[model samples]
Target: MGKKEKSYALGVDVGGSHITVGVVDLVSRTIDQKRLERHPVDSKGSLTEILEAWAGAIEPFCQHEVLSTVQIGIAMPGPFDYDAGISFIDSTQDKYESLYRKNVKDLLAKKLGVSNAQVRFKNDAACFLQGEVFAGIAKGYKRAIGMTLGTGAGTAYYHGTEAHDAARWGEEYGDSIAEEYFSTRWFAKKYQEATGKELSGVRELVDMKEESWVQAIFKEFGQNLGKFLVKFASEENAEIIVLGGSIAHSSALFLPETEQVLSRSLPGVPIKKSILGEESALIGAASCWYEA
Candidate 1:
């Protein structure tokens, strides 16, 4: 027999200022890195501009005969109506303001010359976790919690079969919500308060790791994260915790402290840094169609 035909799906990861698209192999549950594409998006741009950027990124794969009818799965940030394919991101978020209440699925479909039914959306946080559970670090675990730590924080819970957004970014923690304490903003804010100097984000802090103050900051952040995870993991009874995002790239700086805190209360629970990185969302998003 001729080599068996392989199936593929288009997976897109929509971020605050950029979009990443890749072809995911349905059988292997992996992204074809050679076909991956990333494009900048002006989130503040007009609706037409944003839609064009997204469609442009996805159009290439559609040109191939085998992928002409490929299903498209998008990992988008919330507050979005995933089921209805409408965007609810408004001015309050500083990004995608023009997309407020827009039907992104229909618009993008029209741009790509595809039917709306060919596109689907899922929460970015949930996609991150789903990707991990589906093919990465949390693969064997029956229950897992995944977090993405960056400009903001994202959380999701996996219940064996699938994952869903945990929507805990706004959860009360200390004097503020969980996002304030668990994100890159927290590191910048804490650093500025201590040294009376401005720092960009976690990357800068990583370079300054030898500084006692920086080390102290990472430890404090880790402890705070551990405390927060204790409650989140306990509530969900998560068997494992997987972390991804820009901040997670610097796990070495804070993971020890995080592990220490968790050891005291949630001992034996494993915390893993994402092995797939950006591709996690891509694979997860594509899996939507495969799983369905």
Candidate 2:
């Protein structure tokens, strides 16, 4: 087999409450995935354990294949010392031991026995953006921005040939404004207030399919994102912007408002929903493995 086909790439996305891993034959655009493997990351579990668990979770999917070399791409939460691959989880909201967590990239490689494996990492949200631009709705757009609305708001900018990357001003000032506005938490809270029910979670509200409540919450989300995009696009002069993540699925409720606001404030900035679905991260992260 050719060297290109022999080297398989692995992508690892570690999120606020879960770890997802994927193996891809980028040469043929073939992929395998393991999703949402929840860990006690916020509990007593060590970062070492979390890393190993993620590696092990992906091993079985590739065992039956003929992969000769491995490269790993890790997507992490930001404000991490990315150059050094050291990160601290938002233990305030999650369950990591912020004071004791170690270098996740090193640990993942060691536990997988790919200690010398080529690896690259960026903010998890950036991976989603890269995934979108590489093969999703935003493909071929040379200048664009990506925003993911989920547990929290996330934003990434792609300019020139450099695709997805962690924000230099992220995970700190990020949470103070737009990130706090478009989050699913707000939807849940609004739903709770609208229904006079102390929600167990957003899932409950989503199940109700209450149009009024949903529209109100998503309108706020769109307004927040639109305001943020106005600032971001004017600064970067991007051509297009896309949204992804779980909340993006509800674009019907948010898109019109978002577009309306963007049209009024930014005039010509084009914005749309991501087409990568959930696989964008896996593909983008795996593609980074090849680039590395």
Among these predicted structures, which one has the highest lDDT? 1
Model 2 sits at a Cα RMSD from the real structure of 3.7
TM-score per candidate: 0.96, 0.82
lDDT of 1 by residue, 1-292 (tens): 1244336788899999999999898778888878999999999999999998998888988887444466888999999999899999989889998999999899988899888988999999999998888779988899999999998899999987878999999999999999999987898799889988887778988998999988999999999999999899999999999999999988999999999989999998989999999999988998887743
Worst 10 residues of 2 by lDDT: 34-43
Clashes of each: 0, 2
Q: Which stretches of candidate 2 lie over 4 Å from their true place?
A: 1-7, 28-44, 61-68, 98-101, 164-176, 209-214
What is the alpha-carbon lDDT of model 2 when measured against the actual structure?
Answer: 0.67
TM-score of 1: 0.96
Among residues 3 or more apart in sequence or in different chains, the pairs in candidate 2 whose N, CA or C atoms overlap within 3 Å are 42-95, 42-96
Task: Name the best candidate (by TM-score).
Answer: 1
lDDT (Cα, tens digit) per residue for candidate 2, span 248-280 = 777776788878888997877788787767667
Query: Where does candidate 1 clash, by residue pair?
Result: none
